[model samples]
Target: MFKYFNPNKVFFITSKAPKYVLILFIIVFTIGLIESLILSPEDYKQSHSVRIMYVHVPAAWITLGIFSTITLFSVFGYIFKNPNFFLISKSLAPSGFIFNIIALVTGSIWGKPTWGTWWAWDARITSMLILALFYGIYLLAWRIYQTQDQAFKVTTIITILGIINIPIIKYSVDWWNTLHQPASINILSKSSIHESMLFPLIIMTAAFALFSLLIFLMKYNTELIKIKNKGLDRL
Candidate 1:
C-alpha cells in the first residue's frame, strides 16, 4: 500500500526536525517550568501541591493522545498492508508506555495528599492501569513473534482492541462518581481554574506536546537506521 517509500523525504524531515524543534522545545520547556513552579499561585484547597497537576494532567493527556495516534496507525497498517505504518506504530509504543507510567506515578503522588491514599480502584485510575497493561501486551507481541511481519500484525490487532479503553478513561470521572475531577475544557463551561493556574497549565501542555514530538522524531529516525542496516546485513 505504501508505494511511495521516499527515503529522501523521510531523511529530510527527520534531519531538519531536530535543529528547529529541539531549540523550540528547550525554550518552551524552560519557560513552562518556571511559570508552573514559581509564578503560579498556590491553590486555595491543596495549596502548593496543586502545582503538580500541571505535570500530572499533561502527562495523562499525552499518554492517551499517543495511544490514540498509535491505534490510528495500526488501523492504517492493517487496512493498507503498509510496513512503514506498522514500523511507525511499533516505534511509538515505547514512548506511549513511558508516558503512561509517568501519568500513573504522578497521579499516585498527587492523589496521596489530596485523596488521602496513593491509589483507589476508581474508574479513572483503573482505566489508566488498563492502558498500561495494554502497552505491556503490545511490547510483548513484538518479542514473542519471530518475524517482523507477524509481530506487526499481532501488535496492530492488540493496539486496535486497546483503543476501546480511551473513551472509558476520558469519561471515567463522569460515568461513575470518582475522586478524579471532571473535564476541564468542555462544552459546559470555561475551566473552573483561575488565570494564574491556567497560564502555567497551558505552558506545560505545550511543553509536553513539543517534547512528545521531539521524542517521536528521534525514535522514528532510529527505526529508519535499523531498517537501513538490516538491508545492508541482507546484502
Candidate 2:
C-alpha cells in the first residue's frame, strides 16, 4: 500500500475528496464547537476555560499521530524504494508542524490559568518541546539538501530518531513529577471523563481527523502535480 502511493493514485483520490468530505467536516465541526462551548459542562475545578481542552488535546493527538505516520512512511520509503511515500511524509509535515504549534500555544494558554504560570520546564513540557524541535529540523532537512535523495535520507533519519520522543511525551507524567496533569481519557483503562464532556471531545476529534485529511489530500495533490511537472512520474 505504501509502495504504490503514486501520483495517479493520490490525485485520483484527493481530486474527489472535497466532493465527499468537506460538507461532513463543516457540519460535524460546527456541531462539535456548539457542544463544546455551549452544551458541555465545565470542569467543576477549572470552570469555563476548561473548554481549551477541546482544542489542546486534539491538536496534541494529531501532532503525535502525524509524526508516527511520517516515521512509518519513512520506513516504507526505504524498504519499498518509493519516493511517493517520501512525498506523502513531506506533504504531512507542514500541517503537523502547524498543529504542533497550536498544541504548544494552547497548552501554555491553559497552563497560565491552571498552573499559575505560562511555561514550565517539566518532563512532558520539555519532551514536547523536543518533539517540536525534531519536527522543525525535519521540515528544514528537505530544503537544506539540494538533491531529492539526500533530502529524503536526511529527513528519514530525523523522523526515525525522533520516534523516541513520542513515548517520552506520552509517559513523562508517569516517569517523573510534572506540572502537567496525567491522562484523563485513558484507553488502557476506564476513562475518567463523563459522557457529556466525552461526546463533544469525540466529535471534535473526528472533525479534526477529517480536516487533517482534507488538508493532507490537497497538499498531496499539489506535490503530485509538482512531480509530474518535473518529469519524474516514475517516482
Candidate 3:
C-alpha cells in the first residue's frame, strides 16, 4: 500500500498530465468563485465583511497544506534520492509562500473590522508569520546555491525542519490565550456557523484548493521542462 502511492512516481506521472486536467481545473475554479463570491448570502453580523473568510480561510488552509506537502516530498526526496520529489517540492514553495502572504494580509484586513486592530501578536498570526519566513528562507536557498544538487539538499533539510511549525499553527489558539477564534468547523463538531455562511465558505475553500493545485501542477511542469532543457544543453 505504501509503495502504491510514491511521491516520485506521482510527480513523474503528473509531469505528463493530460490537457483536460488543466481545462477542468479552470472550469471548476471559475464556478467555485462565482458560487462563493456572488451567489452566497451575507453574514447576519458581519454583513459583506464575512466574504473575506471565503478568501482568507482558504488561503490560510492552503498555505499550511502546501508547506506540509512540500515537507513530505522533501523527506521522500532525501530518503529515496528522487530528483522528481525535490523538483516538485521546490516548485510548490513559491505558491505556498504567496498564499501565506495572502492569508496574513486578508487576516489583518478582517481583523480591523472585527477585532478593531490591524495587527496583533496572537499565536495564530505569529505562527503564520513564521511560516512565511520559512518559505522565504527555502526560496533563498535555491537562489543562493551555485548548484541544483546543493540547493536541493539544503532546501530539503529546511523543509523537513519547518514541518515542526505546522502543528504550532494549528494548535496556536489552544496553546495560547490568543485573540484568534477557536476552530468552529472541525470534523467532530457540527458546524457552529450558519448554513447560509458555511456554504459560501466551503465553495471558496474548494476554489482555493483547485487554484493551488492548478498552479502547483503548472509550476511543476515548468520545472520539469527546465530540467529537461538543461540536460539537453549538456548533451
Best-matching candidate per lDDT = 2
Task: For each candidate, give its TM-score against the true structure.
Answer: 0.92, 0.95, 0.88
Go through the candidates in order and give the clash count of each: 0, 0, 0
Lowest summed lDDT across 10 adjacent residues in model 1 is found at: 1-10
lDDT of 2 at 12: 77
lDDT scores for all predictions?
A: 0.85, 0.88, 0.82
Better of 2 and 3 by TM-score: 2
**Per-residue alpha-carbon lDDT of candidate 2 for residues 1-235, written as tens digits (9 for 90 to 100):** 5534556766777788865788889999999999999999999999998999999998899999999999999888877778888888998888788888999999999999888999999999888889999999999998899799898889989998999899999999998999898999988988998888999998998888888887888888887788789887567
Task: Let me know the TM-score candidate 1 reaches against the reference structure.
Answer: 0.92
Query: Per-residue alpha-carbon lDDT of model 1 for 1-235, expressed as tens digits?
Result: 2545454457668867977888998999999999999988899999999988999888888889989989998888788777777767877778778889988999899999998999999899999999999999998998899787788789888987899999999989988999888877654678778888888888898888888888878887887787777774210
List residue ranges in candidate 2 displaced over 4 A: 1-4
User: Considering TM-score, where higher is better, how would the candidates rank from best to worst?
Assistant: 2, 1, 3
Residue 104's lDDT within candidate 1 is 96
Any runs in candidate 3 off by more than 4 Å, and if so which? 1-19, 232-235
Clashes of 1: 0
